[model samples]
Target: MRASHAYFLFVGTLLTAAGYGATFLLTEHFRALGGSEIDTSTTLGGAMAGTLIGVPLVGWYAKKLKAARMGAMGAVSVAAGYGFLALLTTLTPLIALAGFLIGLGWGIFYLAGPMALSERVTDQDRGFWFTRFGAFQMAGIGFSPIVAAALVEHLGLSTRGAFGVIAGATLVAAVLLLTFEALSPQASQARAQTSNWMRALPALLSSRAIYPILMVGLGACVFSGMLTFQSSLVRGTGLEAGTFFAAYAVTVVVARFVLAPMINRADGDRASVVLLALMILGVVTAFGLVYGVPVQIASAILLGLGYGLVYTVIQTQAVNDAPPEHRSAALTWFVIAYFFGIFGFPVLGGWLIVTVGIAGFLAAVLAFAVAEMALALLRGRQTTRKPVSA
Candidate 1:
């Protein structure tokens, strides 16, 4: 990889680690502050709410600003949020504000980083680069708990202190992003010519990009449901709570790194079908089969291979399908759809688990997986009949 690409990936990895590290520790931090369960949930909800608001806002501005600069601004917001989080002692609206800042920052970075990278690379190499970027992202998420543990256990820092450290790291990321923008070629900074997104919405939604957006949303539902409730699902299955996570993380990193070229070379539509099927099999193995460690691990591997590879494929498709001028908008909608499922489905999953037990939750997840598979098939057929515009 070029130095610029490598630097961009490193920055992405660092930002993700700082952002997700704080997120993983949020509950513990709130509880440490003597906050109630409701406070914790509400605070987290604030973050999700902020992300829902941020995605579109960033998308709108993406056309006007350099993606790297927007990402830097996002990092600043995240740092500010974390800095606020470090100083809080009581539950207040400030807590929500902090969460919102963090979420909004992440929302911007999520869209901006990919947008920037996509613009920098060619279509032929886009899938490989995206897969690598995603691998780094997963690595960040997977290793954050370890970093937090080191800080708290070895460094003798409190959870709040860790937030302070994370805040510093995020600021560093912001600086690096600015440096990246300075060193790279300047992209258009002119304002968008369109009056507004609402006027262009009909044409944008009518494109083949919708298929990947829908697939991503559905895929997020399955991914979140499985990960969020893995512990609950395995409560009595003689499995460790971290089993799925560890296995899944390792599998994703390996699959994305090792299989990216194959994915790049494969036919997009057929690959999506097969990959989505693997995800369904993973879900079935985890929830439907007799609960055991081997089965659980197998399920994790399947999910890792499936979702890990397919995400890059479909995301590339989402960009590839759009008109050049609308690529950012397409990606904007794609990220929004993903966050909606990531934040929205867990609430529904929690309700189902509470109302009708784990069976109900598993059934709902399966339905999503099936629906996603059906959509992949539909998209494949549609593409065959009418190839997506270049």
Candidate 2:
């Protein structure tokens, strides 16, 4: 790997920490600012809207912007987003603006990081690097809440002060990413013959590509709801949000690091079913949180395994399985659905919290998980595309 690319991986790891560390504070911060439950959740919804806006723009300009420039911009956007959040003292619509920038930055990284990694390495090596990317992301995120707990719990830092730390971390990523050298001639030329990304939408919808989108949507919804309702779900269980997030991040890193090779080598369609099944188990275990902490811990383990593997396998399929020229376009579609889950579902979940109660929420989760599993199985049977083992 090139030195610049290696640095990209290192920076990517910190970038994850930067975005996520700030996030663990947002719900509580917003609530402290007098936000109702629905209002607090809307902050994430705004971020998802930013994602919704950013993905297509990234798709259109991906090759033109090149990876290095995008990385710099993305990192800056992250810092700015957090900076704004840190400065805010009370509830206002401006929280949405800050969330948008955060999502925009992440959205850019989601496209540019993969674009750069895949272009730099050979096809056989893509999966390995992507696996490391996931692991590093988990490590950074895992480490953050601990640090956050120290700053807030022990050091007496205000919530806003905590966000400053997040901003600094992302700025570090920006500086490192800016040092990357320009792409070589071969990469530049291949990127020049760009596909009209919009033209392929109809085809992607009808094909197997849609299945991963649907299945990942399930995972995204589960993740968003878990975080959005952290207080309510674990109210009687005596587990803090930090504990839950720490367990999740640790489990994901361990599972992904140990099992990367097996997952990367598996068929996308079939692998998705297994991943979805694991997610189903995780969701079931998660709903058991009302029962207590042991179930929550078990749920975290299952979720870490399931979510980590699903993204690696399913995303590889989205980008790698596509015709070379169309990879960015394919990723755009996946991202659209990914954010939709983040943006759309939480609002619905928020309503359930206000009205339908725990039973209603559990029922919704069950219905979604079952549907996700069925789609995964059906896709495994129906997909005609030959699987590629990296």
**Candidate 2 residue-wise lDDT at 158:** 80
Q: Kindly give the stretch of ten consecutive residues in candidate 2 with the minimal lDDT sum.
A: 181-190
TM-score of each: 0.83, 0.90
Per-residue alpha-carbon lDDT of candidate 2 for residues 261-317, written as tens digits (9 for 90 to 100): 877667677777777778778878877776667777787777777776777677766
Q: Candidate 1 lDDT (Cα, whole model)?
A: 0.74
Total clashing pairs for each candidate? 0, 0
Residue 205 lDDT (model 1): 82
Model 2 ranges off by over 4 Å: 3-5, 181-194, 319-325, 384-388
The total number of steric clashes, by the backbone 3 Å criterion, in model 2 comes to: 0
Candidate 2 lDDT score at position 175: 71
CA shift at 137, candidate 1, in angstroms?
1.7
Residue-level lDDT tens digits of model 1 in 1-390:
366645754565566545754565565576678864345445556667878887777666766777778888888888888899989877786787887888788887887776667666666776556677777777666556557647877899987898888888888888877777677644454342222444555666898888899999999899877875665687666775456767887898898788867776778888888899999999888775355788988998999989878888888789788777777667677888888776567657656765788887888999999999998888887875332221
In model 2, the clashing pairs are none
For candidate 1, the 10 contiguous residues with the lowest summed lDDT are 186-195
Residue 63 in model 2: shift from native, Å?
Answer: 2.6
lDDT of all predictions: 0.74, 0.70
